[model samples]
Target: MEQDVSAFLGRLAREVRPRSNQWAGLLMQRMRGELPELWEDEDLARVALSETVDHVTAFLDGLEHNRDVTRAELPPAALELARRFAEGGVPISTLLRAYRLGHVTLLELLQEEAARLTDDRQLTNDAILRLIATAFAYVDHGSEQVVTAYQEVRGRRMQRRLFLANEASRRIGTTLDTARTARELAEVGVDHFADLVTVDLLESLLRDGGPQPPTDAPLLRRIAQRSALDGSPDSPVGTGRSHTYPAESAPAEALATGRPTLLRVTTPDAPAPSTPDAPAPPAPPGPPDFGIHSVLLLPLHARGATLGLAQFARDRTASPFDDEDLLLAQEIAARAAVYIDNARRYTHEHTTALTLQRSLLPQGPVDQFAVETASRYLPSGSRAGVGGDWYDVISLSGARVALVVGDVVGRGLHAAATMGRLRTAVRAFADLDLMPDELLTHLDDVVIRLQKEEAREGAEISATCLYAVYDPATRLCSLASAGHVPPTVATPSAGSRAVDLPDLPIGPPLGLGGLPFETAQWELPEGSLLALHTDGLIQDRARDVGASLTLLSDTLAHASRSAMTPDEACERLLTRLLPERRVDDVALLVARTRALDPSHVATLHLPSDPAAVSGARRFTTETLTAWGLDELSFATELMVSELVTNAIRYGKPPVHLRLIFESTLTCEVFDTNSTAPHLRRARTFDEGGRGLLLVAQLAERWGTRHGREGKVIWAEQALAQPHLP
Candidate 1:
């Protein structure tokens, strides 16, 4: 039976040779009509079906009579069809189903040809059995080959995706800009993953504190969008465009459910019937040629919250987005979301710290009676953030001014708080009329105490300060440094010089130990400039401190020193020396020296006898008359009598009295006693206590200033503008 069947198959091959082309065409027609996926891809489907039919017909034509099995080897074309399916992101199940359906068509044709040739049941049955055996053998071989090709191509595609994942992980999130991070997410998709990309962030996240919209209609603002198409990048709804999603919108659903979505975008010119279940169409995405076919909306979820959604789109020229592409888009969005959240948190903190620093600083133009001054304070860049640089102009007794510039050890709120504590202490100490060196000595104690407290909490503290006292009476500037840079002093006679100050005997920085601090006194003349600043004004990591100081001196020397007010000098110095963005905090205070003219002063040396009180009062009354201050003489005489009597009767010897005529009438009595006077209520029975009490009431301000040898009891009465003759 096998021999007869083989002979019959060989006869059948010869007889069917004329009509083999017709049989293959018929099979192709059948598959196209039945399989819709194959028909949609007309080019690949026609080529693949044509090749399969040609091979099947050739196998029958080449059948042998003596062979036990008919040979029908799988064609290389079958492997190519598998590759094409994989490239189009089509499933392999359809490829196998098509081959099975084609096998049935081939078998049906074999039976019909056999019946037309012989009309004998036995011969037809044997031909059918041999044909079925050979067909199954071919189908099995081709199916195996196609699967191998499919998997090989699929593997390469997955490898490429892996490379892209690594590329996105390495490139995105390199900066702290939240918008840049979103733009980078869009950038990653263009030309590589999709033809067009857009990133939509939660509007609530970008807006300052506010209540959110409903869950189904949460707002999303498109932060970034890019396109490979020539005109698509100019799309209006990108990079800061906002849109409110309807209840069934894709973005809303994806965010509300915390899941990624793959969807079909409606065509540009398509008409829509009103369907309540339909998602509202998003705003027009600009140019009509953008041709969006498929969209993948992936939620950017991190830290238990959905930050935003990333949308990737492909035009009609490319295949629709698939599950694998959606997965990749989600992965990329996930990476960028983490970086944006971090940037958002940092921005919140930085803004809060900046606000706190500004509030803690001094405000308004500060005018001490003895000096007119101006100052500038600049904060560092975002990288360095906020630091503790502060300056103050403090008014002291005897027409002295305390110029303070200090820098705390760190940045942010903690450093600013430390600066506040030190500034408060400096002002309190200045009121006591301590010398420059003594004020810093007391400030060092406060710093050490603060450091101890900070250290117990596992934090270290250190600081540098320049404290200077300028006495208009003597035209002297007393300066002390706690590891601070020397201030710049400019004069018409001397030119500009960075004062070479000696370091305090104390350890460097304020918090180290109790050490003796050295005070340097410069006999600054009228029109002299004393520039006190934090080290940030003169020091940076890239430049040498000496070089910076020399540059500062030269800049000041070359500037028009005589014409410059403290404000002009400060503005010019900063414009010439500092860049737009500073790396460290800067605090600069400039004071132009104004000495008390000799003509405005009247001095008298008195014998310490009890009779010197009347002479002191007479001297004050005559001096006030000569300076055209007669209107102030009554109050002035009363203050002089009380102060000089106290200085001679109970105070030390070598008493001298002086009256100064400037903005106010100043009367001072000097003695060798260092004890500060106390104001007290005079009892009904008390006699002499009322003298000091009466002085306090007659003078606008009264205070005691102690020198090394003695103390001066001074009173200032507001002057009436003189009637010039």
Candidate 2:
């Protein structure tokens, strides 16, 4: 029976071998009818046909030799076809079904051939049974090999998708800038998955504290877009420009429903409906022909709110998106949406904080006779948000001006509020004509109290401050620091250098009590440039403080070479010393020193006796008339007499009087008395208590500043314009 079966199989192979092409064609036609997805790609279809022919030829050869079907090797073409199916996104089940259908068709054809070759009923039955057993074994072996190949390719594709998704997640949202984040998302999509990608946020969402757009037809601003094609033409609506999607467009539908929509372009004219039977939505507005074939429109939904829309597109050269691609795109969009939303929130907060900071800061240029001043303030970058850096120019008494620059420890709204409080406190302290060290000491107390108040909310506060007072009358600048960078001074003879304070030690930063701040005085010549800045100007992650300070000094020296105004010097320093990426806020205050002209000043010594009061009054009256300020004689004499009489009566001896002519007429009484006089309301019967009170009332502004050996009681009366004779 075995010999008979072998003989029948040999005859069957002889008849079937020449018709292998015909049989392969038949099998392909069957596959095309039942498993149409496998034929979507023309290249894959050709591969399938060639693989079918090879399989039929191999089967016939094995039958002719009567080989063991179980030991037969799978045709390379068959394995290649299976891999193509996987790569082409055709399902594995479809490939297996094709194999089963081929096996059944081949078996039926072999049986008919066996019967035609054998006339004996017993021989035909035996041959049919042998063919059935051997064909089944051969088909089983081939199916296993093809399935293995399919799985290997599928596994690699999955890994690639997974790696692309992870790379997108790692690279996106590295910065808190909305535009940057959007660009990152676009680049990731174009590099890994899509031929083109675009990110469009609602116009209102980008505005600070703006209301959400209406859902019917939302207006979107294209923040970022990218394409795989080099030198791609600009989109119809460029980045930063706004456009509205058609009401029934895929993007609008996706946003309205908060669901992703996958569209396949069946023709060049328009995008096909998401579902085959459903009506097509309106085409999205864009350039006439981008050759886009597949589009995935994902709403940027996060935290239960839809913020914007992200679109991923594949051109004609790329394969159409499948269910698996949809899944991956959703994941990428989901991750990107979270970061975009975070960036949006950060943008709002940063704008608000910066606005608050700028409003609280000084608005215009400071006009002072002691110095020509200009200032600049910059908030931190998006990642760090706005910080608590501040600068101010406070006009003090005695032709003096106070320059202040300070930095709170942290960032955001709380730090900005803290900065406002400290600045106000500094101005208030400055009004009293307190020394630089004394003003900082008072500011330190305010910060300590603020910390105590904020401690209940689990927030700790600390800050660094630099305070300097420039007196035009003495050409002396007294400066103090509270853990802050020292100011730099550029003199006519000497180059720029940081003010070195050997005797005055730097005190602890504010919020730490019990540290005494000491003052250091430098005699700045006329036309000297003084620069005061927050540490952000000279400190960064890439360089040390020493190097940054050197750069600052060099820049200042370069500016000092020319007759650069304070404003020009400020611009030069910022251009030279500021880093590309700033993590902290920067505050720069520049001032050019001016000495009070000797001809504008009048000075005299007074004897410590009652007779000297009349002489002092006469000297002031004569000086006011000489300076063309005769109208101020009466008020000036009254103020000078009261201040000098108090100094000689209740204060120490060696009284002196000086008159300064400037924006205002200043009368100062310097006595070797450390006791500061207080302004008091006189009683109805009081005679001597009204001296200081009268001085305060008559002068535009008055204050007393105590020095090491004496105190200065000064009053400024506004200079009235002289009438034309």
Candidate 3:
């Protein structure tokens, strides 16, 4: 071996001499940019390239004397580079082959330069063989130690990846909230497995009641991001804060195809391609100045559907990810995907329950005569407990109205369904003209029965309710509660005050219905504001109920001082009282009191006699005429005469006729009797039974409203649109 090497060295001692730039240029020209890890760091590549040229020039220069480089004579910079390549875990074969390309180029430069310098074919050929031999000797001597270091580095990295995978498995899928789950994924990946991590979800899946995105391509929104690069955007779009990934890009393709991928790095100068399915995403605040070079995008999937994707990115300074790293990343993504899918299912159910509740709620006032009303309902910020509160307005017999507000004890679809049932029962009881206290007792009974009928074995049905009945003429309000929050009354004289009935004990909440519910009477004067609400509007886990109610009262008082409409009052109250993030549903109703003007109302008392019927007719006609509702007086007078005559014949004493002129003309006759007059169609031959029938036909609507004093038989006529001069 020594003699053959000496002979080869003797041939090169005469002719092989390479210039620095000549060989370096040749080496670079021969390379096709295929180096993965080394090419990533341009500074390192430049340093390595320059050192290689120097080492070759110096070694060839040394070979003229001794023809070989021992361990002592080896270039320090080249030896240091070999150690770096090993520590960096570069494939020994690729590195050796890259160096061989440089060797081939340097040898070619030596042959060409030598021949150009002197045209001796024998010497040039001899120098070419000698330089070729020198190339083989250099590679053999240099890489002998690097290959061992590289294998050691590769083995250590494998162990580190296994440790990382175990660490990630224990950390991910611990939470069922989708955003939190995504955040966990990003947090675990950053600084450990990758330099930057991002988790993006399909846009449609984030919305309530949103439909499924198209299978071809779906838009994504970044939910969580973490970055190791300084001031670099965690996402591919927007500011360094967070944003969506570009369409037709790595992350989007991963999600759209439900596939994992290692994305190709995009150059800043390349025009981004656009497709119909994947429209290009917006450019970010910074230029495409991201440090990310290697990206691993793994789709987050469970139940055969893609929830989103987890992206792990490494900067140019980091090593390129291999197949094993990609596998570990995919495992982490799979674990987090389970929790995300669970959260999505919970969201879908919560939305459906809320939708069902909203669909069941009464939109606006059904009873326009009693009050000018407005209402607001707000769901929890988390949207988990949406269906527990409700409000309603029901029109009663004498243009009186019933206002209702209630809340079920628990939440979800069952609570919403129960709220609907209780609301329906309130309306039914309101139609019967039941007193507020009586109505609550019946509602309590209904709820008890509902629980028994539904047989919710483990779950019990219970709720709180506020029922109020208002009489416009009397300007009286009778309110009753089933362990509910007392209402606040904001009158012109008194800014706002809770109608706290000191002596009135609130009955047990519905479902525990043995005790009788008591009614508290307070005259809510004309133009007064009544605010009724559920506990959610006033109370939260962090606040005291009394303190919340006090705040609510002050809020309403402030709103009332502004002379706001009922709707405006509700909005103002909500703005002030509702917390930034509410944990429960809120139901609120604000009604302004309305009363009939004395001038619009006329009344006459009468003894038990047939002649009083004519007097009742005269009173109705004159009252309608004076109010400019004379067109309706003919029908009103006829209905009144029939009602009064019926009361006289049925033998009730101290009867009275009352007339009210408003949007509609109404005539009411009060009798000492408790019997309610029923309307029936009389047979064609029966003239005797047609008086009540004639009253029903003449009046647009008629009904009896029972009062503590007596039963009121009232008839109504829709007034003419225009009044004649």
Candidate 4:
């Protein structure tokens, strides 16, 4: 029958795949191939059946769910179980009768088989008994180790859980949705479960990483307990009497009881228990196995919230775990609390930052300027995108206005504060009636002082500023830059051109001194638009400022020239010009010159429009008022008349009149004259030659330039003040 069953088993194995040597060997050995002929006799069949049962149990032990045992090592005893099953299985009574013989009891036989399948180190019976009873079986038996393996694992797990919970609580929009308290509890449970056993109790409990723990008190505690031990209620490391327990029991007991318990046990081999918290009394006289002793329990709670409790004990009649242990547990609880609170605080701060950022950005359009204005501000992405970028439109003295935009160095509150200061300074300077260049110079001084003060306080900051004044009446914009990108102009007639108002960055970035500065001026045409921006708009990975500028220029050229409103234009340009992420902050201002349409001609025709003569005097005063020069307009007319009279009489001219209107009035009379006009000293009595001298004295500036047509004599005069007579 045994041979028939063995053949059947081999045939079954072949159905799966032809049996390999390992399987073949197991089958051959099961057929009593390795046993003596004497033991294989008919009467020994009962013993064989009994041994077959034992082998079946061992085979089951060797079949681990995970990587616990190797198939190469299935015992010869296990093959016999397979053969017995293949034949007629043995009865329970038959196995018991065999066990009653000198062979090991079922428990001992199973333990031996377990040891073999698990590949555990071989040990004597006494050692095996001690191992099943105490956790020391898992720990190295060093002479000086204080806490048992169980105690150490518990402490470390508790600490780890608290930490993980705290982190989850702090983040905004966290992966865990539960309340901080509950989440923290859950975190503790999950970490501990993962740390202790093959069974993933903690992960299973948090399947889907559940939102913070439920407020249901008992349920939360159960969850915590389930995580602490494989859902067992027994103590993990210590218990009453010298009887031993499994290594996964200490936290399980604390979790199940919903209360903390201290455990103390005196094994037969160690010293006696002493006063609580004291070292265990000296070793008792006996073999070395009897010295185990005291234990202590402490619960963790904080801010009226209870976490879980813990239990700890010594192994060799050492001092009982005491207040020190409790105190440490309490410390761990406090640390856990702090971790949770910090996590929440971080979440709150992040949310607040986003809201403030949205609120602080400019909301609507600024009124009064004629240009189709647009602007873009980009903050650094790494930090909360908040920085000191600003733009403002302020109404000045006349129908005119001041447009300002600038960025401060750095980010956050400091940059914001600097931006505010510089903006206010620009308005104040503009109010003082200083021209753009002079206003920028004054601001440079202010920046320098600010930097010095900041440095003394161990804080460093630097900034750049650009100031512009727009006169609506004259349709001109005067600009001054302080180490800023020169504003670009896109004219209806001239595609796109950047103004050449280059200067060494103003006042050494508002800190360092001895910086030289110059101002550049350009004639703004009707319907011409200008864009002023910070370096952030152009910054890229090329590591070169020029490269960044080229990229910016190219982007601007390709940008859609849609007929959108000023705000929309700004939004579109910004959306298209900037990269998705920027390394620095950007602030930009766009303004266009309002269009101008002139009616009728005001002309002063002269007969014998001579190269050197004078009909210009009568023409000057009368023609200017006709052009609405008024008190504001008188200065340009008088200077123009004088220069024209001088050129016609002394020098040469076809004798023509050219009027250029801007914030200041400019008048020139072109003559076929080759001599450059010079400002020279005239004696007080010199009348005729003194005409040009008086023109110089009365006008803001007077000069002569050889133009494409001829030598043109020009003079500039400030417009009359508003309400001026």
Candidate achieving the largest lDDT: 2
Please tell me which model should have the higher lDDT, number 1 or number 3.
1
How well is each residue in 1-725 modelled by candidate 4, as lDDT tens digits? 43433333233223323223333334324444433332333444554555444433332332222112222333344334323322222332332333223122322433453354333243333334532332221111211121232234445544654665454445322322224443443344334222111110122122332223222222222222212333222222221112111223443444444354545454543322222234434434433542334444444333444343333334432224434344443444455444434443433443344344435545666544345566666556643435666776665433356777676766566667677777778877765546676677788888888878888777776776777777555666766666666765555554443334334244335445566555454566666556677777767674577765655554443332433444554665577556777877777776666633232123343433453233465555565666577674445555765766666665653567655443445566667766776667777786666667778788776665453355766666766652222
lDDT of 3 by residue, 363-459 (tens): 6456366689999888887635565799988876665788889999887888988888888888877777777888899998999898898785677
* TM-score of candidate 4 relative to the true fold: 0.42
Range of the 10 consecutive residues with the lowest summed lDDT in candidate 3: 268-277
Which candidate do you rate higher for lDDT, 2 or 3? 2
- Name the candidate that leads on TM-score: 2
Q: How far is candidate 4 from the true structure (C-alpha RMSD, Å)?
A: 20.9
> Where does the lowest 10-residue lDDT sum fall in candidate 4?
195-204
lDDT, candidate 4, residue 339? Answer: 45
Q: What digit string (tens of lDDT, one per residue) describes model 2 on residues 1-725?
A: 79877977887898999899999998889878988866877877888889889888888888899888778788898998888778667788877888989888888888887777768999988888888888888888999999999999999989989898989889998988789988999998887588888898887787645437457777778899998776443345568777777677667788898888888766655532232123444444445555677788888877887778888888734467877888888888888888988888777888778889999899987656899988999886648788999999988887789889999998888888889999999988888778888888999999999988988899989999999898898898898999988888787776455444345567889988998999998788898888999988987788899988888887787788777999999999999888898877899999999999888889999888988999999999888888888888998899998998998998887888989887788899998878888877778987668888888789988988877778899998886762211
Model 4 / residue 102 / CA error / Å? 27
- Tell me the TM-score of each prediction against the true structure: 0.80, 0.81, 0.67, 0.42
Candidate order by TM-score, decreasing, is 2, 1, 3, 4
lDDT of 4: 0.48
Q: Write the per-residue lDDT of candidate 1 for residues 243-272, one digit (tens) a residue.
A: 656566566777788888888766563221
State the displacement of the C-alpha of residue 634, model 1, in Å, after optimal TM-score superposition.
3.3
